[model samples]
Target: MPRAVVRQRDARHPALPRRAPTPPWTRWAAPVLLAVTVVVQVATPRTLDLSFLLAAVPPLAALAYGPAATALLGGTVLLLLELPHYDLGHPGESDTATVAFVAALSVLFAAVRSRRDAQLVSVRTVAEAAQFAVLPPLPEHVGPVRCAGLYRAAQRGTLVGGDLFDVRRGPRGVRALVGDVQGHGLAAVGTVAALIGAFREAALDQRDLVGVAARLDRRLVIDAEDAGIAETEMAESAGDTGAAGTAGTAGAAGGAGHGEPAELFATAVLLEFAADADELRVVSCGHPPPLLLRGGTVTELAVSPGAPLGLGLAGVAPPEQTAVGLRPGDWILTVTDGVTEARDASGAFYPLTARLAALTEVRQRDPAALADAIWKDLVRFSGGVRDDVALLVFAWER
Candidate 1:
């Protein structure tokens, strides 16, 4: 078993309670502060100037025990410091005012902490719902193609990332697309929705796969430019890197021009399979090549060698369609980088081809069964992914 999987299993055991690590500064702050306090009392002895010491207490305590504990500790320290004054009957009015100040500070801290927790919970909930809507449930079969798909997000609470996959049975044939956008979260999901919507519409109207890709590319480019403007405004305010690395890559893949503004592009593999003719046509645009598994052997389908869809770059050419003959008992597997690039704790990539080779021995050849097995193997290999993943498999039974 991979180390990450082992650790995850160990974490789940009821006997073990996960403990948060102690922050280095938090662990030593109180002792250091107390030492300073004592030193001031002994060395200078002018009643010990403790105003600075009192001001530092809340922040230090908050770091150690969280907001509530910090507030409690701050109040306790104040009471202790004021005790000497109270007993001496010196400045009784000032002591009372100090206590009231501590009370107000504590209440403020607690309220802030509560609000932060609520916001985090709300964000997580919304992310989960969005993920389900974008991904949905994979169909057992689409047209004559038996289909299976798998997806994962690199970050926790992010169900849908830049990666996207969709299979549709339409009037033309069985069509599927696996693509990765420039980034993750809502922005990526928005691009995916636009691309999928365009593809669905174009696939029905356009007889050629190239035409479909072109149509989708146009829509994506427009959306990306518009989104980029919004992103730029926000980045200026936040001082964030505005679509630097990922955006550059997306644009390069799409074949954007040198003079063109940075835009979101995608690496995508499009597939159209005609059940009547047992023919498979594929167009790959800067995307990982799909694997065709047959008789326990896996073969990588050739990418049509086309530029990614969005680059307005000059001299960039569109991708061509590559055809493959499909036979009974043959299976076609399509996946995004999230599958092939999945790294375990040891930094070893999952052996997708080898795993699929092993699956040929299984007696069941149904599309769902094949897909499920592949999905399970991928999860086992990655010990759970740190990125979003999508997998699709189609099998023609003998």
Candidate 2:
């Protein structure tokens, strides 16, 4: 049976657990705040000592009811409770002063909350956009190979992380690459972007996978060094003055200088599927070996194991290219450590090869169905992912 068809069938057979519902507290914050206000009122102080607690109520209410309702509730609470505590030097004077202070404070709190909410929304939007642009959607098919991929960042609201994968049909054949930067977040994303760009450019220009890998390594190192120089200059400028900028500058310098070489380096596997020759070639750099699944058996391809790119290691031998003849209906699966390393509640790693073999026996050679079965087993094995997992499967059809 084709892996794609098997994956599609498995996707329809619900396997994973359903997501839990959001808690009541997240839905009804205003009532919670009102209850807190009652408790505070019971324990109120005789003097203006209640000012701090009263001031806190508006922000809490805002979190529950939103800005406008928060302001209204806050204003009403102040008028009913705090107004009587104020002394009137003249007619309507006390009322005017209390109302003025409450209104001002309420508006200030609401404005701050509104601004924060807007900023959060903006960040989420940008993150999603970046993720979509950087991580292009996986193609349904490539040559005789059926391909599917998934990436999930460990951090919430962050779409793109340090992981990346690219598959393209070229003159050489169908080439695919999956890589992970040493760290996470924006800095790692920058390296991923640079590496992916270099890979695409070099892959087209160079027939050798090793050449493509080297080109990407050089690009990443150059970018890392440039960032380091900028940080050093900022540090020196700050040192000349005793301003608060000095601390920030020093921290930046420390982070850039003392950062691990791995943070600058990337682990990758580049694969080439020559459909005409019916062979698969691979080059690995400190990355997990690609698994070749055929006839219900899985084998890790042999490749020269070398240091991850951008470690600045000299005299290191270049990676060796390994090739394997593909049988009809054979499929190659490559993934980052995120898959095998995913742990369950008992801290046991997912047995990817074993699971793949099991699923292969049960499902037909449908690409989609195979992908679905593999992902379901992955989720079940890991219990849940602690980091992002990226998988690329390529199969030869007849």
In candidate 2, position 320 carries an lDDT of 79
After superposition, the stretches of candidate 2 with alpha carbons farther than 4 Å from their true spots are 1-61, 64-115, 242-263, 312-315, 343-348, 361-376, 382-384
267-311, model 1: which lDDT tens digit per residue?
A: 888888875688888988888888887775789887667788677
lDDT of prediction 2: 0.68
TM-score, per-candidate, Cα-based: 0.60, 0.68
TM-score of model 1 (CA atoms):
0.60
Superposition error at 319 for model 2 (Å)? 1.7
Q: List all candidate RMSDs to the true structure.
A: 10.5, 8.7
